[model samples]
Target: MPQWSEQTLASFERKAKETKVAVMVTGSIEAHGDHLPLGCDLILPTFLAERIAQKTKALVLPPIPFGESWPMDVFKGTVSLRAGTLLMVYHDVMKAVFRHGFRFILALNGHGLNTPLLRQAAEEATEGTDGTVIIVDWWSDLAKSVRAQVLESPEGHAGEDETSEVLAVRPDLVDMKVAKGARVRTAFRVVSASHREELLPRGVYGEPEGATAEKGKAIMKKAEEELLLLVEQLEQGKLPITEK
Candidate 1:
């Protein structure tokens, strides 16, 4: 895959200017669970962005290794950013990408909360630039694959689905011997009424009891196929997301 960070200024200018579309891959640094690493959010999107770039012909930027994760702050190693800071910094990055001459941008987001913030950044990137920006939540987009291939119930943090995915990419990071399942149905919003402790008692929200490397591979494969199709539609003027 052609990477923006690896290219010399001259080479980047030559290829990036002609490409017209680029993908900024990013995720958050937060707690998943006892069995997963703090970089779980960072790993999936960065890995998928490279694979997506191979087929999309768009330049891939180095993934942002941190994100806005207020809800998970109570957990150990749960690094987070202020919402305002994340919004402004992300907006600046989008503007910079547009200034570099890529008019179409796909912001591949790994963390869930970052999606709306990225959409805000994309709005700023689009103003006066006549560019198109879209945020693809890799996990949410492939929920079908998760349901069909991995978990029978909804997947949660460091749960069966996510653990399987990490196992696929970085199997050494998983210690299934200590893996556990946690399911909860919140009475209100997780961000507003319920914090991490009230929402996920054991630091997880989905089943991780039977996760495996093979299941992760299946989830990834399904996501790749679905996302590639979405990219094609975007090129044809169809947006993959809808406003609620």
Candidate 2:
């Protein structure tokens, strides 16, 4: 499948009708750490979407690079969007894709804060219509078990898992020399605006120093397999939920 941004209008229309599915990657421009790039969120999901689309033949939409990151807004590179504004952006994009007769949309989210809003936007976009949207937070959702298998440290912003992934996709951008983090041991969730600063003073939450390209490749391979399975199911009319 072709990237939506690169497709000619005529080719896109023709291919979209044949494909009937699209994959959109969403993430945030935020502070990952001193070592990782601010665009870490976008890089991983965009990588996943491109890999999956190769097999599934789904059109890959351009990435949505800003998300709700108010918790990390204090960080220098963090660009946070208001909840409503992010929701509207997602809704509008999904609706536009659906309107073009591509009913199945796989929204691969990279930021945790964007998950609920993405869900809401997906629901609103497909309501009263035959369209269906599958929202996947690639790291938390697809790579959860893989993290346990391959990662030595707990997951957090720019942690072992994420650093490893970035290394696998773009090793040139990673700086392992200064990679560091504090082990975050949270009992439960709390609403503290200064959470990142207080708990993670270094702006990192896990052991990024332990990150390796091998672990990252392992995580990505599992994610790709699972996503391929999902796309297969959707193609077979076995997804998008059916009420009992």
Candidate 3:
């Protein structure tokens, strides 16, 4: 798993000739309750991209760290990119990746809100470059199949799912003593977003009480396998759109 940022110019050129696509992991800087790091959105995707690139032979580019973090910013220390700004950054990065001679670009996204903007960047790539780009909303795209495997009760901001993921990355970052679940008074969704703390005074939602590093490893394995298969097939000239 070579990091594009660390490779020499000549090394990059040589490696670019070896791979057909580059994988870009994108996430946001936002609060994830009191226990989880604001980087929870970014760290997991970066980890996945590094793992996936080993088998995919795709270059793992440095992750884009800012995303749509508004509303959540009320929690403090959260930074957000306006949707238009996010789109421009993604588009520019993809264009540069294409210019590097890769014909396929994979955006492995950890933050859900960035999906639409990433897709817009993909559309830009489709229309503006000779390369093809794919945006995978890492959790949402894989959750269906994985839920069957892990059997968690829906997702929350810094709940079991996210906490477990981070635990798998660094157990030291998690403080289970202070972790707690939320009280959902209704099934009704709100039209106007409330400050995150208003919803869960503890700054966390869902019961992270059950989270374990083992579950997190299983979840990540499932995602990495899917990503590896897709990249392998894409490079074999058997991209999804071309499959019979």
Candidate 4:
């Protein structure tokens, strides 16, 4: 399927008339340890969305690169949007998409902190439109399967799993020298307070040295397969949600 931005009106109209699903991928600009680039989160969802477009013949919209990153604002170079503002942004975008006559929306998200805000936005969008929105946090949905396949530790926020994904997508963007001395932290140990200064001084939460492009490719492949399966189910009107 052609990306929404790249397609002509006729092409888009044709696709919309044939299959009424539109996918929006989003991510954040946050610190991802010293090894990975700040665009790590942004790239993953965008990459997966492109793959999804290729697999499911769905129209892919341009990704929103900046997302909720308040928790990691302590780190230099982290760009964050307030949760409320992001939610409204999502709502407006979703409404516009729905107004264009798409009846199905898949919100492919990569950042962990953006989950709650995205969920809220999805709820509001669903309430306001006839379209069905599916918010997908790729890592969360595939974490169990990834961990089972991984040989190293996996946790959220610049962990082994994320590192592996970056390795697979853009190896040149990674600095293995910096990842060599990376430190790991646990969410359970850090969530008692909102002060990241006292909790994670290193800006990382899990081991990243064990990441490899091969492993990343495997994980991403699995994720794409699972996403296609979900898309097929959604197309058949078998989504697992009970509306209020």
Question: In model 1, what lDDT does residue 189 have?
Answer: 61
- Tens digit of per-residue lDDT, candidate 2, span 1-244: 5788888999987778777678889999988888999899999999988887677777889999999988778889789999999999999999999899986888999999999999999888999989999998898889678879888877788999999999999999999998877665667876687576876555677889899999999999899988888887776756846699
Measured against the true structure, the TM-scores of the candidates, in listed sequence, are 0.89, 0.92, 0.90, 0.89
**Which candidate has the highest lDDT of all?**
2
Count of backbone clashes for each model?
1, 0, 0, 0
Error of 2 at 185 (Å): 4.5
What tens-digit string does per-residue lDDT give for candidate 3 at 206-238? 778778898887888888788888888767755
lDDT by residue (tens digit), candidate 1, 1-244: 6788888989887777556667887799888878988899999988888787788767888888889888788888888998789999889888888887766678888998898899888887688877788777888866584557566556678888899899999988888888877777876665653556767755688888778888888888888787777666665656666799
**What is the lDDT of every predicted structure here?**
0.80, 0.87, 0.80, 0.80
The per-prediction CA RMSD against the true structure, in angstroms, equals: 2.9, 2.2, 2.4, 3.0
- Report the alpha-carbon TM-score of model 1 versus the true structure: 0.89
Worst 10 residues of 4 by lDDT: 180-189
* 1 or 2, greater by TM-score: 2
Model 4 bad stretches (over 4 Å): 180-195, 241-244
- Any runs in candidate 2 off by more than 4 Å, and if so which? 184-189, 194-196, 240-244
Overall local distance difference test of candidate 4: 0.80
Report the poorest 10 consecutive residues by lDDT, candidate 1: 187-196
Off by over 4 Å in 3: 183-196, 199-203, 241-244
